[model samples]
Target: MNRSNTTALTQPGAPMKVRNVSKRFGAFTALDDVSLDVAAGELVCLLGPSGCGKTTLLRCIAGLERQDSGVLYLGDRDVSDLAPQARDYGILFQSYALFPNLSVEANIAYGLAGSNRDVVRKRVGEMLDLVGLSGSEKKFPGQLSGGQQQRVALARALAPAPSLLLLDEPMSALDARVREHLCTELRQLQRQLGITTLMVTHNQDEAMLMADRIAVMNNGKVEQYATPQDIYDKPATPFVAEFVGQGNWLPFQRSSDSHANVGGMSMRLAAGAGQAASGRLFCRPEAISVNPLLHEENLFPARVREITFLGNRCRMSFELNQLPGHALTAEVGSQDLPRLGAQDIFVALPPESLQVFA
Candidate 1:
């Protein structure tokens, strides 16, 4: 359904919807039955591994790439086949895509087509200031640093005040230092303007830090779309659970009741035991605790395999001799890390924290 006709889609007050959209390059499928929604003024980030059709989907929405089937709606307009310029959306690419000959001010003013000279000047000035690039308007693209050039690109995109903003890995081109600083600044700017924006990023940290909601895609399909917390906590599938965070799967033999023999350690299933299969148990690194006091239940013996010291925490891998083929990882506070080498460690695997899947 197109919301454009009801006067609600573009309301700045309304939402944007992407219907069952699919794109194929001859027999190769780039996007398969993808659909999602963004509330008015909401920021949604599309995240996935490379070649997962994220860019194709973003391009389709921007009118830069057409889909084989399904409709595209912006605020209430059916813009499935509209030209990129006609769609009235602003885009920022990974490379910044700034015109080398254009001065900072001109680059920003490029999108303000035919507005009065005074009006154009005012908008450009406002955007430059908003993006913290106030005095460098006359500098050409080559004169500015990479970060400054990016700010210019951003200023240009926002200058038009397009209802919808599309960003394709906008930070991938920047150095690490600039990328971190810009990520916060970009998010702040988006919130301040209240523009409904969609960004495509392969960096999980970027997605988690910037988006109000994230749509995790894989193999040309959206595996999950949810709040960053939900996507990390209650992943809908094994792929999602394994992909979103660090985890390990242990083999188990199913018992008559809900219990399973996880390796030689018979671990109890928390509630939905009946639904689990006999083969594997999903254990998140953070879910397992290595506290000194061991609880009577869920505690197991394991030898210390290796320990890597990370600034805030230490990552220790525990090798279970009972489960020869599997290993468990745990993150312990640097101060709480147990001395290893000669000492054996007894770890507690809370039943509630373990997820058993086929």
Candidate 2:
């Protein structure tokens, strides 16, 4: 959608403040003193595995579920005690929740009741055009494809031009290709309208692709919150390091702030590597080079244990000679497989790539 058109249809976004929100059910705690702030016009994703309180937190914000203790504010208005309908936000569910009996136009115009009929009709048409479903106005939800139904639901949520948008796994039901396409479209639309949005998803790729910032939750608390790259490269916790992406963890004994012993082989640590007496060193598989250049340091010998072809790249498993029974895997280009003959291979682990955590 065009910028001018989007601005004309939607109101300026508002910031949402959440302070020390806590929720519980009987003996179980769903949210544990969680706090977050969503800036105006920013898109943030609550990301974690299932049952991690991401959904519970989103529902709390929407008033679908109330928090036992916390303060919620949309801009300057305190909305902590307001009912769902009384809050200034619109929500799109994973199921789309479109009225199956109603036509596309009717669904989009549902929130426009009590207004001028002509104005509602015009607004519905504009929403349909904005979501690229203008020609399907007469079609029922059941008649349209999954993607189309989702578009209709999105149109409906945007029809009233709410200041905040809440999406709860909105694309999970669609196929992979369709879900990816919709993610891109949704991000573009959100940016064009400058709507403050909060989304809940367990999919790492989805959060990384769409969110301006991500809050990684674990066991009813936010473990870390930062941009996608920051979360991946400099995770604040070991769980965040392992959960967000693939990494190799090798047990190490620290001898000093700048040195550690991995499998009895002494290696220099990266600058600013925490002063842990002993811990595991974390490094991404891609950071380990199969064959070392002459200038590379920390070269170690390992034997290829197995090889698996994965379309464009090959995954090779290696047994580190110094650390028997321990294995490491690396992603290598398919074309370079021949260079790795039937013999021991040397791998280089760059110091800067290693992160030591106690």
Candidate 3:
């Protein structure tokens, strides 16, 4: 494939807008008043647990399933009523969905059926090269490894250069090591082509690594939509805080707009944490410092009940002396393991690391 000819197959991605979209399967509501927008050239992940309506929403946007009520727009064009073929998008599925009988080149060229023969051949070769499958063109899907087959599927999906790309757990079938490598490659390719992409995944780590923004969904509604860091560091809801990452929820009593008491130890609160009289204080295990100095404001005594070595870090579970039944988990670096002696230790919960939700 000629490098200069690649331009003919590439198009700038278009922004996608979904307004108040809802879908129902008889008595069950699949999507409920869902609304979101993806900027041109941006990649967003519709992340959630199973049966959360993420795949349904992706199907709706792809025109495979119609919403009960709502509008869908691609750039300035309303595509809600358009057919799948008319929506100007390409999709890669979890199963790789390749034709067993077709060769890699033929599969990639499948969507280019009516194009000029030479042009189709050129586009196929270009796609193969783009996906790092240049030498495997003649091999059928059955002869390729799982990762290679997925690459072929991805190449086929991008062969048409659609303005939008939809991925339904595209890397879920590959092994962990392959999935991680392909994920990085896919992100690089998406950026290079600048395709407005929406991916559906139940994996939090995958979404964090790939998406520019994440629309976290649950039970037919988007729980939160934000950048990965914000979603993890400053979750909009308790569910978002718990689901997006690992954290401990401890009971706390609000003292004022900027202070709280946890297990009788006074600690500063985040600005808006005092809205509730009492609530659960969410703190990531990694946020707590084990055996900090006694001068720390939120320092508390705890007996190390169990310690688990996790490579570079050690995970320790502590039974808080102030609250016997309650326990907090802390991740201490391997270098600090010796500092945590055989007795009770001091744990500090910094105010900035605490998120309170009523």
Candidate 4:
């Protein structure tokens, strides 16, 4: 809906806190002492692989699944024991949970059943307009495409103007192109509404694109909670580094606090490298330059075993001459491939870009 007309949807958001929440189903622990803070008007993403407790956590916050322990607070109020109906939040599931028999307008107006007719009508219209589905009010869920149905579900969730929004893999069913487009639209709308939001998704690209911060979860525990850039560039754990982006790991012997021997070469590492004598050295694929124009500290003679083009970039399999049996991958700009020849090719690992973990 247009901001000028929908006053209720513009209400300021509230903070949400999940404090030491834990849940278990028989022998499986879905959430193990999980906790996080969602600031007022902030968007946080619960990012992880399937069965990582992200969805379980979202359900707990929505009161659909009660935690076995801990408390939940919404805007300084204890909402731990409240029922789902009493929680001032709206949720949209992956399935887009619309009644096949109901029209789009009816679905959007479902939450306002007890409200006056005029109020419900106005709210439904505003929601449909806000989601860019203004003219499809009469269409049934069966008649709408997957993307359209997703927008309808979004409109339904916002109809009540809830203070918080919980989305569980909302765009997972859509095609890549549609998912990308809707991610932009949904993020813009959420910001405009100023609603605190938590979204669960296995897609790193979506989380990075939409969330102000991401909580990377693994095996029912939070591995890292930070901004998207921080999660990618300064991962707190090995699971986070491997999950959030593409990287290469090398088993190496630690020579000093800032040095390691990897791929049969002595390499300089960034400060804060772990102290373990033997550890794994991690470097993002993009950080490794093949035949770099600038001088590098850990440069070595390397051979390209394979080159796979991926539009703007090329993924090249690399093997250092000193470590012929070992392989590493380097991502270089496609346009720069012409500058290299069949000889003198080198792989440069910038010290400041390398991370060591035991």
> Model 2 segments beyond 4 Å from truth?
1-4
Task: State the C-alpha lDDT per candidate.
Answer: 0.81, 0.90, 0.89, 0.89
Model 2 lDDT, full chain set: 0.90
lDDT string for model 3 (1-358, tens) is 2233444456999999999999999999999999999999999999999999999999999999989999999999999999999999989999989999999999999988899999999888889878777888899999999999988998889888899999999988889999999898889778878889999999999999999999999999999999999999889888788788888998889877888877787778766543777989889999998888456657778898899999999999888898887877999898899878985888888888988888
- Count clashing residue pairs per candidate: 4, 0, 0, 1
Can you write out model 2's per-residue Cα lDDT over 1-358, one digit (the tens) per residue? 3334777889989999999999999988999999899999999999999999999999999999989999999999999999998888989999999998999999999988899999999999899889888788899999999999998999999989999999999999999999999999999999999999999999999999999999999989999999999998888889999889888889999877788998889888888767788989888887888875465778888998899999999888887889878888888889888888875998888898888889
Task: Write down the TM-score for model 2.
Answer: 0.97
Poorly placed runs, candidate 4 (over 4 Å):
1-8
True-structure lDDT of candidate 1: 0.81
Q: Candidate 4 lDDT, tens digit per residue, 59-121?
A: 999999999999999999899999998899988999999999999999999988899999998
**Sequence-dependent TM-score of model 1:** 0.92
User: What value does the lDDT take at residue 19 in candidate 4?
Assistant: 97
Q: CA shift at 52, candidate 3, in angstroms?
A: 0.6
lDDT of 1 by residue, 251-351 (tens): 78777465778766788778853375576777778777674464656777787788899999988888776775466799888887744335477777777
